[model samples]
Target: MITMSPASSNINSTDLDYYCTETPTVAIIWCVLGVLCACVGIPASVWLLWVLVQRQRSGTSNDIYVVNLTVMDLFYNVGTAPSMINYIAFRNHAFVLLDEILYSFSAIGRPLFMTCMCMDCFMAVVYPITYMKMKRYRYRLLSCAAVWGITPCIGTINAFIWYSPIPGALYWLLVPTIAICDLAILYTLRKPDPSGRSDVHPQKQRALQTITNSFVMTLVCYLPLMAMGPFLRLMPASDQVKFCVISLLVYIAPLLGGIIMPLLQLHSLGRLRGLLYCTRDSGSSEQPDQQL
Candidate 1:
């Protein structure tokens, strides 16, 4: 009589064979996208930071948040691409350890930085007085430090507990917070002044719009993982479903973030280009001050 232990069966059931025997089409696609993402994400992030350092000495509070998110994403884009290229060119010789290490950081770092951006918008719109008080670049720098400090703890949880669950928890926790903040700002914008001037302050309205856009990115990109968490992490799925889930987590999501970063800031690219060229701001003030 043959019998299988539950743990043994579970271990044996992992279809790693399918993972290794990839189709040529998938490899080519992954390689192309990986290189394109890295190409665009790396340069854009670097130039943005260069503009921050050279042009905006007294950068507004939002600039600080943008710096943090851009830096984290640069690390993510640079870190995730090489292994894929290597995988395509040299299969087993690919430095997969790079992928594992970089993915670990990007996995937590991306959303956390995004949360800080959303929270910065929340405060800027909902608590304008407090936001005004936070104008000093040094203060903003210190606050960014606090956000960056979260990486070790998240990395620890990922190392010990699980990686994907953190994003799920963050979605549940932060989505409502951001949504409430957006709604509150919209409410404030709609209310009339003492003279019955029911007009939204331009900056406040812009902030609200950016926050709303950020929420959309979060919802579209991250929410599905929350729903899939139980099945991917706990319950069993067929090989195809499992592959799709892992692919989304490891590949699609990061590429989306890299792509979406530029798109979200498409408005700012004009000002950014001006800064790059060492030219005076032709219309920086007229442009929207923040990105989703």
Candidate 2:
């Protein structure tokens, strides 16, 4: 609940800051959303990790990325949990800075791993022989290690630079790359094989559907924040309410992926019954956690 003040109303749009004065109700709402993110993210990541561990013997490259993705989500949920309390009872700015650093990790990590997942599928479908040639667990592990190494560097840049564009730039770069991979996958799958085969492999069909769904999820979770920069620029300086709403959505963006990813992985793998502890002997139910 922000009311327009005379000082703010008089400010030039170019010099206006991003901060919007908020009321107790707004703070409470943020706290509640943070609580929901932690409550859902923690157990879901833990459960997914447990499931992955159970199937590690036959896990694929995608599972390696999924493992890191889940870890990043857990980091986001746990690392930012303190901010919920700080939201309701305003804390020192230093605490908020630390939270922003943690957020930067998540912001980079989620899309980074998602891009890995898409690229993995891209190689698998588009170049089967080469994909198989390089398809070792160690290679995937190395890739994950590389992404982990990269996260801190970019995250640090975002943390120290006020209103840094690196995160958004990274997302913009990834979005088109992911789209091309998705389109390539779709095109490759739709074209008939030169071998005169009428049937697509069941696993390929499943993989296509899973990746498409993930791409959609990524867009849903991230597009708003990516678009926020332009929208904010067009908005008037004194429009605090819309600014606050967009700002909240940007803050909540990291959490959306954490909550949705686990459920998406479960559903795509036909393992929803695993949530109930109801054992199933079906082959699909026994499949490894491959979707991200």
Lowest lDDT 10-mer window, candidate 2? 1-10
**What are the per-residue Cα lDDT tens digits for candidate 1 across 39-146?**
877877777677656646755434667767777777777865666655645544224433444554455565666676666666765677998887556866776787
Give the lDDT of residue 190 in candidate 2.
85
Q: Which structure among the candidates has the greatest TM-score? A: 2
State every prediction's TM-score relative to the real structure. 0.69, 0.79
Taken over the whole model, the C-alpha lDDT of each candidate is: 0.56, 0.67
Query: Model 2: clashing residue pairs?
Result: none
Give lDDT: candidate 2, residue 255: 64
Stretches of candidate 1 off by over 4 Å are 1-15, 18-28, 58-62, 90-95, 129-139, 156-164, 190-200, 231-237, 244-246, 249-251, 272-292
Q: Write the per-residue lDDT of candidate 2 for residues 1-292, one digit (tens) a residue.
A: 1111112121233443334445345545665777787888888878777776667766542477887887887788786567667644665456655666567556777788888888988888899899999856787788799888888777656545555667668878877787778888888888887999999888877887768776776677777666775566666655554444545656566566767887777666667766555654454565765442
Residue 75 in model 2: lDDT: 80
Q: Judging by lDDT against the true structure, name the best candidate.
A: 2
TM-score of 2: 0.79
- Report how far off residue 232 is in candidate 2 (Å): 1.4
